[model samples]
Target: MRILLHICCAPCSLTVVRTLQDMGHEVTGLYYNPNIHPVGEYLRRRDTLRQFQEQMGIKVLYKDNEYDPQIYFKEIAFREANRCFHCYRIRLERTLFIAKRGRFDAYTTSLLYSKFQKHDVIADLGRDLAGGGQVGFFYHDFREGWKEGIEQSKAMGMYRQDYCGCLYSDFERRKKLLSE
Candidate 1:
């Protein structure tokens, strides 16, 4: 199966890419995260994913690297309490649209790999976006490879970020650290 994998970052994509290839699926990465806050952090993650793609000889499609935090904030501002749900919808909708245009058999995301993310919500969103079987949602519990992915990323000298993207997540991370 040809699959378009939505990559959030290099560390998260490492195992997902490997696993898909091992399972005999052709995977092309799509890097489109407008939700990552601050231009520096966004560039770092995008560059890291590019580095990994080069090293692995994987094909990837990158959206324009325009720093537009306003677009993200605008989408989630009113829905701050359910920001992630809006965030997931924005990204997944785009992924599915791309998958349909690219003629990919299915689409999945590295978001599912993070224990910090709401997996059920993402899965449901993917399913909803993939309605009518125009493209399938390739659901996999990638968190099972979480530890190994971390080790592999470290071995590769990849940049592993501490927070889920976005200013809100960064603030939450700092808050948790202070509390601890």
Candidate 2:
């Protein structure tokens, strides 16, 4: 099946790309993460993805939007409890739109590969997006490949980020360190 893969970063995309290809699926990667803070970090992530796509011979559809923290904060607003729901909504919504326009047989995301991310929430958003757009959400728990994915990316000398690419995550990470 032809699939539109929402690639969050190069390291996460590595396993997803290889796995989907092995399954005989035509994959096109989409990169859109406005949540990543600090323009330099965003650029680093984007460049890493570009390098990976070129080296791996993958077709990438990159949307270089401005890094607007307001979009992320506005979504969370006073309801920090449902921050992830909003985040998933934004990202998957964009993926669904791309999948519909690109005429992909289905769509999935590298976010599924994150052990830290709320996969169920992402899955729910993906399903809703697909349903609303009449597209299929290929729900693969790519977290199964997390260790191997990270190891392979490290072996390939790819930059590994410690944070989850959001200002809130960054603050939380530091807070955890301080408490520890």
Which has the greatest lDDT? 1
Over 58-88, each residue of candidate 1 has an lDDT whose tens digit, in order, gives 7999985544777788889878999999888
Leading candidate by TM-score: 1
Each candidate's lDDT (Cα)?
Answer: 0.89, 0.86
Which ten residues in a row are the worst by lDDT in model 2?
Answer: 65-74
How high is each candidate's TM-score?
0.93, 0.92
> Stretches of candidate 1 above 4 Å error?
65-67, 176-180
Cα lDDT for residue 180, candidate 1:
83
